[model samples]
Target: MAQLIDSLRADGICIIVVTHDMDLVKALDARLVYLIPDRPGAGKVSGGPVQSPDGPDGSRPVLLPVAAMDQRDEPPRRSSRSAYIASINPAFRLIGAFLTALPLLISLDWVSATVALVLELFLLMAAGFTPLRIVRSAWPIFLGAPGSALAIILYGKAGGATYWQWGMIHVTQRSLDLALATALRILAIGIPAIITVLGIDATDLADAFSQVLHLPERFVYGGLAGLRLFSVLRDDWSALSASRRSRGLGDENRFKAFFPQAFALLVLSIRRSTTLATAMEARGFGGTEERTHARVSDVGPRDYVYLLICLAVPVAALATAALTGRISYFGN
Candidate 1:
């Protein structure tokens, strides 16, 4: 591994190594970049060559000295109640999201879609999410729903009473009904997925996928590893932007500066990925035999309840629409 890193360095390639292995860092003579969390969505970075305390042959990474931020004095408080959406097995939650979304996508009537939307809102609240949190996380749906509805209202198949007509655009009672149904359907499908998936831990999801869903362990772990880099990328972007501002480049057009910074981020991501892949290889990640999980993932009664809700909401929505004579099958 040391020889590989040395060779890469010799080839004029820069490597960014992210690891706790001090020996590996020493072998590569890599500078340390310390990320100290000073606040939510913000942090401080201290970077320099760190000298090992054990006379340059230490087996542990040298801890960088970071000044205590005043904000760190009070830690964030934890919620007393466990999040309902996060408690269910991730596999079950995923399957439930799929089941709940499928019907909303297929239903072509306002009544069924409205029922599904109401049920989805109830589920979101049941999952312990506040209305503000739901809107914050699923704002795209809120915006896109109205936009989609307007598009459908203007361009959807026109029938029933004609309200307006223009070049390549028509509005009618049937089209307006379909538009409302489409908007409600978007909310129904999107809200549940966003609410359930927002707080899921990547590691837990990986475990559930590998153990409960019988997915390929290598693929699951690799994907989880990749997901871990998302936060790092965000931090890198913040740091990069800050550095640019400090260099008096902040006044430049952001659109012009975006490409260079994005390219730099892409380079950093590739280097990190290479290092991660090497570390995984060293840990025998892609061995032919199956590996055991440290923690077992299981589906229980709560998971069953989630699945039941997923199944029930769509059925009840369709049933209500049928009874009200508002059921409109797709394509007819």
Candidate 2:
């Protein structure tokens, strides 16, 4: 393939080599200049490789995948932050994130939760996500965690001395402690989970599902198709909203206008899904023959190291909680 590409370049035939293979570019020592057509209808794609005029001897290849791509950077520059993340296998990242949070469920004591959160915070910083970046990417986790904590604070079965009482809401020492533990636990579980999946490519995850996890190809590819079209839904919603505004419905109550807009979006989704299904069937995806993947997604030494850290964090948290006499599983 390298020889063929070099021969083609020599023949003055410039072509777009679509790939997500960073190693291929590095191995060929070829620089890529990404181009997105200046057309609104040109969907913002995430990964495509455009060979630069500079051939193999030019310079080291820098990965700059050109696309706004799912509300990410437009003509995205490969930041160091994303580079660290993109190195891991998507399947292992998914597994590790869950593993790191799972052992925290051994006990819901504030000690364990706080210790785990602190360790996770350090790890997140080490992974090139600054405090600000983590929050920006995982704001939903932050918002939901506090809301959950607030509910616990308000009505979490008052125990020990009460601090304040107003109607059904009682602020007690035990509730305060429980709320703190709940908040910390949510952050501990949610932050790393969010960060692991920050820049995950759907194709890579699909490949991982098929190759690493041995999932059915039909299910994996169908999932990939769904993820790809999810961005289209955003575009469809925006277009629908704009169309409504043009028809002078923009000033109407948002709550009242929501149902019609939702119904329209659902109709559009069904039409698109039908077309996509037809296309997939035409491509032989409906056949019983086993399909082969063009790329591989396997765990490496780094992945093992990451898995170790995931195991260690929760163990250390629980151990520390036990030392403080705060750890109790299932209220035992």
Candidate 3:
């Protein structure tokens, strides 16, 4: 049961299981989903009692006993409370995630980027995202930034007093500054964007998007389904890439081989999409009713502060450049 839950978690599936087997529920670490049922006399809580584990000292356990899903005769039917809460509005999570990426998109100054990166790091730390994961995710940005900066230096020399000239190219002091600025800008934007979204859980993101952002329910659910499938496809792609390398296919890298592999991945993605769609439809998704939150996403006061700083830093940098005559608007 623990393994099953782990697998479901890895696949980014949101599941609310029902079971009478107490041990299984404990094993699965499932959360109790309470539902209030309408009775003839009065309304009463229809869900089963919430049980919790005892502590190491035999005190009451911290977490409540949630239902475990099981394959058995006469499976437990979902109650209104259980079903309603189980389906989280994906809008909030999605919108929040997108907004979190905003700082990286607009900020250009090193100071702005630096501040944004720090704030994003703070959020990740607060949200329990591992530092190792953050570092691992942010490294690629540095790897690519230099190359992009080099491109700007090589190509952005038009109308500059050429210090050195070659075929279709010129090098100047201004070009050097432009290269450094471009590299810094890229690093500033890329690092925060990656870290802010790296630890996001897809189902929670979907729920947040639906509830907070008021996105169309069908679109939110569809995106969730796609995200789940993408995880599987990414894993498959990695495996196939490795296998091909081992089989000497990687040794013979030609245009033909690349096209076929790309095509194969496309076909695999389509098949996975079809299979996921059919499975979701079979499970009675998109039922006629308003969805409720299984969990809620909140933007803390810290997020607002960070957003303000993201907006302010670039403005400050521009202001500083203006006062110092260092700011050149796109070399105009």
Candidate number of the best lDDT: 2
Write the residue-wise lDDT of candidate 2 on 139-254 in tens digits: 99899988998998999868999999999999999888888888989988898888887777778788888888888777788878988889888889999999999999999999
How does candidate 3 score on lDDT?
A: 0.57
TM accuracy, model 2: 0.65
Per-residue alpha-carbon lDDT of candidate 3 for residues 136-255, written as tens digits (9 for 90 to 100): 778997788889777766776655567776776777776766677667666555655564444455766665666556677677788888866666777777776787889888867667
* Count of clashing residue pairs in every prediction: 0, 0, 18
- Rank order by TM-score, top first? 2, 1, 3
TM-score of 3: 0.53
Whole-model lDDT per candidate: 0.78, 0.79, 0.57
Could you tell me which residue pairs clash in candidate 1? none
Error of 3 at 18 (Å): 8.6
Q: What shift in Å separates residue 93 of candidate 1 from its native position after superposition?
A: 1.4
Give the Cα error of residue 79 in candidate 1, in Å: 10
